[model samples]
Target: MAATRIWSIKGRLDSVINYVTNPEKTDGGKYTDTELQALADVIDYAEDEAKTHNKVYVSGINLSPNIARDQMVMTKLQFGKTDKILAYHGYQSFLPGEVTPDQAHEIGVELARRLWGDRFQILVTTHLDKEHLHNHFCLNSVSFVDGKKFRGGSKAYWQMRAESDKICAEYGLSVIKNPGKGKNYAEWKAEHENRPTVRNQIKDELDEIIKCSYTYEQFWKILKQRGYAVKRDVKYVVLKPAFSQRYIRLKSLGKNYSEEAIRQRIIAARNGIRDLDKPKSDYNAWLNKYEPTKLHGFKALYFHYLYLFGKIRKKETPQRVSFYMRDELIKFERYQKQFRFLYDNEIETVEQLTIFKENVENKIDEMIIRRSKLYDKTDSKTEIKTINAELRELRKNLRTCNNIFIDAERIREHTEYVARLEKEANEPQKQQIKDYVIG
Candidate 1:
């Protein structure tokens, strides 16, 4: 089966181009120097890198694969439409082990051709590094022919889905016949992994409150006292938690936590009966399972930051993280990439990382000169393609090295923050140790 998704890119067009064209799903790091300044506009390196496929699977419509970035940027400049939304990025993913890489690329090319080939330039790349082979499309927001912007609305998505289904049917690939409303990636992953979700959190809190409540009125009153806004007179008992933006209906939390169910649960509670079916979880078990070990250098730094974010579990006092960093905590996967890149490269000291980046940059320059010489000397397409492929790989490496530097700076800053947090969290323990020693 093939599923399609699309979104707008409001940032620099080059970043999206660079990401989609990344030769392999490799590279991670931070900002440094003027190069680092450009890295600031990169939306999510982890997500982009994960979706990057083999260069052989990459194709461009009305543009060259090697110079797709320049052509897209030039088109935007020609139309005088470089502000706000820069491009529209869409993807078509197929079920795992269902189709060959060449077939996937062909399907992607056909999709882009039939959809926007007449009006716009598109770069279609089939990424094979992931479990499911997927195609990534980078479309210039401005049309090359008429200077018109592509509108990506509900109708656009419907058309995309319809076209993709038609193409999939032609290829004899499975298509989602009655696709229902889909959840966002995060929500889907959370549900799949049985992770804590806002809905589950609400249900858990309600369960606790129900045990203490004897009547429906008392139950809502207690919920309000706990900073939850409730609209009890509504068709559905809608509740808005202080930390959440949208109101959640009581019926949505499943039949067990429905308004009538909650009332019955409260009645049972008053009659000396408890809902023992509500599964209890020991949150501290995660901490207990983690073995404390000493780590030095970049690995140690990344480990502690992840630990502070509640990603890593260890038996230790809870450290205070800045309220602003709560969002960052949800992005531990990105942090993990940063850590893995450093680990894989054996990047220990700042000096080592700087030297590595410089080496890659120097190599890229040498490869560029070599490629230029080959283009001038040889009329052979094969030779030119081979050199271009080599150049793409080297360029991807250079991008990763640059990101490593950029992320290293941020990592060091968080390292200091983590140190301060640890010191604060450890102050009581240290005081107790000192008192016992004196006694």
Candidate 2:
């Protein structure tokens, strides 16, 4: 089965064009990525096809060969329009082992012609890099014959899918009758292979935190503490977990995991509604058990270490005693390393920690500037390889510096919290502080 999706290209049009028309994949103007029988006579033929059909005259076509002329032409057409939509990028992917790359490309070109032949100028390129055969369509927003722009909406998308399904049927390929929902290729591939996806991992973490949280804000804060980057937009709540490079939409998780659903669950829990599916232990009963108290610097470090190493439970410990189970001993050794790091860096005071953080920040800034210059200088393949190697080393150092800075910040925050607990004499305030700290 083949699935189709369309998206608007708002900026950086050149990069997209270059990627889809890279000579290495296209096999030197063979259009090997596509099933098109007509071989391209020149490089970046798909881009050239799009540019030839462009109605608006654009400058610097000869001067800037690296820039996507088609995109530049589209931009010129959109100069006076109120709508800022530049171009539409679409993808048509087929099931692995179902169709050859050539067949996929042929179907893709036919699909585009059927869908937008009369109205839009489209360049269909088949990409053969992935497991499944896929086609990329870089369609001009404005009509070449007429100056009208392609107004895409729900109806247009439905039409596109219908057109693709019809083409796939003609090619004697299977069609997905009920495509309930859609996921990006990577997520789909991961799921198809029965591998644990980043989304599933994030959901597991979210479920754990949601079980303990009483409000949406608290849930978000807990996720942040667990090192998830969260961004709330008008329609969806997106989360990028630690070590992940991409964000997953909450709604895409499923009906039970949408933003509204999560909020409802939080409200239900607050009103004493219990989710029978979740285990009782998932909800931390000792959330408010710890009482934060001001101590001398050494005492603060001692308690922090105990808490850090999980020597003391969330609740009070009868007395501080050191035990050496194999795991405990290993953790103690790690704690000793951290203690040495603090001592060696002179991070005993908040002021010193702040200065150390600033230095790390400055180093990161310097690396970033150096990386930018390297990228700008990369023209040849050898230069690119050399620059990438340097960038990788810089990235490693940056990550180490960032981890250290985060650790210092966490220590400072903990110290400040303890200081605040000492200043608050009211019983209720102290209880609130304890609850905030332990949770």
Model 1, total clashes: 7
Candidate RMSDs in Å, in order, are 14.6, 19.0
TM-score of each: 0.43, 0.33
Residue 102 accuracy (lDDT) in model 2? 44
> Candidate 1 regions off by >4 Å?
1-182, 195-250, 269-272, 275-292, 304-329, 347-439
Q: Write the per-residue lDDT of candidate 1 for residues 1-439, one digit (tens) a residue.
A: 7899889999888888878756553112322344433322221111112233312455677777667889988998998988888899998999998766656776787789899998999988777678888889999899999899999978778888889877776554666543442223345455576554556557656877898898989998888987799887988778987656678777877889887788888999999987456454443343343333645576667766666655322223342443224335444555666666666677767787778777866765665556545533436546755754565455555656666677767877866776777678788999999999999
Clashing pairs in 1: 29-403, 29-404, 29-407, 30-403, 30-406, 30-407, 31-406
- Write model 2 residue lDDT over 1-439, tens digit each, in one string: 8888888877765556666655445442333434322233212221212223321111111122234445448545554442466667888889998875545665776677678767666666676667887778776677655667788877777888888877665454667554555454435544574334556556655776777898999999988987778888646678877656667778878888987888988888889897676332311222224232733343347346545434222212221121111123223323444444554454555566556666655654554444435433436435534543454444334343444455545555644554454355355677999999999
RMSD (Cα, Å) of candidate 1?
A: 14.6
lDDT of 1 at 407: 70
User: Model 2: which ten-residue window has the lowest total lDDT?
Assistant: 54-63
